[model samples]
Target: MRRMTPARRILLLVAACVFLACTAVPAWRGAKIAYHLHTARYLLGQGELAQALSWLAYPLQEQPRSAEVHYLLGNTYRRQGNFDRALRHLAKARQYGWRREEVDLQVVLIDVQRGDVEAADPLLDRAAVHAVPDDVAVEVYEALAKGYLALHRIEDAMVVLDTWIQWQPRAVQPRLWRARIHERENDWDRAAAEYRQILSVKPDDVPALLGMAGALLARNEPVQALPYFRRCTELAPDPTQAQLGLAQCLRRLGRGAEAGQLIARLLRGSLTLEQQATAHYELGLLALADHRLHAAIRHLQTAVDLAPQHIALRDALAEALEKAGKSRQAASHRQQAERLRQQEDRISRLLAALAESPHNPDLRCDAGDALMQGGYPREAVRWYMNALKIDPEHRRAHESLARYYEAIDMPDLAAEHRQHATQAGAQPQLSKPDQPDGLRGDGPPPTPKACGPVQDQPPLQKLEQRAGPP
Candidate 1:
């Protein structure tokens, strides 16, 4: 109990100080980590992604083993659009045995954003195969579906989306994805059904409403789709696309003035060059539908000027100019279109002539090509039929007829052709006359003269009816 030796006292003092320092170190580090984590989260909430990233960096350095820090950092990076860094941190989070499913999903999403779908495929596969929680499993499936969609593997996307929907019927995402896939496949009825299912689940879902409107418009059911389009307009943040879609639906439903007003509003907004051109083009078409040729010409000309590369807009402008009696401008556009059309026609005719010879099974399919190129799609049906008649198993002909019928709004006929094509083991064919040579050569020739608008027939005269009326 008396005074200790100097060396012993020094050693004892150092030992006590060391114990205190060791104890304080963890608390200090823990506090620092907590503070940084909270600050990072706050910055993220405020959308200050860069600031959040800086805050997350310190915590990550201090607690290199911390999974939560890695995950938060990944999220911050993702928000900042630094997909590579986001992926690196997310992968680390998974490696550290963090929320494996959530980190895996972030990795998949980043891969998709970076267009590394092939890389994402294995991660998605692993996530699906693993014993993940239900909510996490749904997320993995959704991510896989999105990955497939990004790669344009639509059927694959549908398979994933359908699986998710079966597991969670109440989930709107799966239905929304299913609708998107259907829309891409031009299966408007199926797309509309899926969209309706989403709406039933989430009545206020703007995307579902917009999708429903689009599907209805595609099916020529604009009248029925109007309410959904209006709802989409009401719920959308910017409401530009919804408003544009509404305008289209209204125009299709013969509500020209209402459509015009919506188009006018869209035009007044700060739109991208492409959007501006599209808006002008749509307004022109609306004007044309209303028989306001001068106004149509004005909007169409502006559209053409804005987007000279848009062949459809240019063609529309020419048509409007012709209706407005601007013969010179119309003639110029017609000349351009004719030049392009002639180039296509030459190839089609050559193919047709070769096919007409009957010697080359490949060339015989050309008759469909010629019919389509010559703007005699209805006649193209005959050529395709004749080709199929010669080679009862001609796949190209069936595929072509299916596409032509679809274009002409004859879904039943199109389905029949598609069935025949599928039976013949042929790929789907496009309705365009200038399709790839592979499409013409590989499958049955397309239907001949299948898509032209029907001319209104003259009213029948009834002498007996006239006498009765008198």
Candidate 2:
């Protein structure tokens, strides 16, 4: 080798220095990204989604080429239910390099929720063939199972849950999910077995207890269900369902006195129309068994009037009506029962919606209307009260509540509700005088009267108008 020139040596040294400078920048950039990502992950776990999004935005902007950054952004967006943003980021993640099974699984969840099963299947298949960390695998499997279940793809959901349980046998959620699938299929024995397995792991799991009790009851083993129902009532924040089930079991076991106590407790609380009807039906059955024909008829009539879709209760009521020597009334009730069948699905959907959005006053008020229409005045009042609890100044809730009170013969209470309605910004009926339209330059506003479908009553003319604007 010949000796190198000084100029060439200097050039080689400068080139080496430039290369290191370029390399060091990426390392420094990566460190900053890792810091933001760590904070974002912590925030995400704490359910501070907005904060997580803010922290994630930094890494996403600073390190676009980082696959982990894109994947995390996609995960966070998906968890926040922003499916479009999620898919955008997830697609970027896939485009930058290769497929991430967990990311693909999350994208598939969005597709499943969007009801694009065709789009979801290929991603799911890809995810199935990839290996992931166990923790990540658990989360992806759960998301897939829930997505499939929501779309009513029962067999797919069952397969996912089954696979998850096989890997982690003591996992409470998958067992509970498997139990629900069995319950939905009406395989009561299998559902009960799954619930028992879950209970063996997490003894105080309220959902499992409720499921087990329901399954046992469906199998006509009330004696075995009673303890589960009783324990469920004790553990639940809203004990109405468990209490009702416990009462039913007690009734079946010929412990009418204990059942009666539970039913009486339930009637005194806030109950939905179905719950109210169930309570009344049980009481009617107990009354019938005691040969108190008139009492039985009254309760059975109340139950049938409130929930005519309950064929079993209607059957009992029709029998009681016939036993009272009124075949014509029995026939009419049977006809009403037939007409009621289709309405149950709508009501059940509304009820389910309310359960998910219990704070929505509009939904609560609509539920009240449905119940009032179904002839459960008392239950309707409870739903109205629930609406008021969520939004004390809700105009429609107050108006409907006023009319309900008026119908129930509580005129004073009705008038008080009219006062609330007016205060809550309900417009008084356009004055009959019609001095032009809307908010006159006249001396004073018209007196507020009760709104909704109610008979005309004396207006609250003496009250002051504190409601400032339209």
RMSD to the hidden true structure, all candidates: 18.4, 22.1
Error of 1 at 102 (Å): 6.0
lDDT of prediction 2: 0.72
- Candidate 1 residue spans exceeding 4 A from truth: 1-85, 88-105, 108-130, 289-292, 307-312, 325-470
Tens digits of lDDT, candidate 2, 1-470: 99999999999999999999999999988888889999988776544567788998888777778777777788778766688888888888888874666666776667654433334445434434443355454555556665555433455556666666755688777888788877765789899899989889889878889999999999999988989998998998688999999999999999999999989988999999999999999999999888887989999989978986578898888888888888998998787776565455556667667544434567767877887776677777767776665456777888998897787798998998899898878455321221223545756433211111112221111122423210
Q: Give all TM-scores, in the order shown.
A: 0.52, 0.50
TM-score of 1: 0.52
Clash pairs for candidate 2: none
Error of 2 at 381 (Å): 29
C-alpha lDDT score of every prediction, in listed order: 0.67, 0.72
Best-fitting candidate, scored by lDDT? 2
The 10 consecutive residues of candidate 1 with the worst lDDT sum are: 461-470
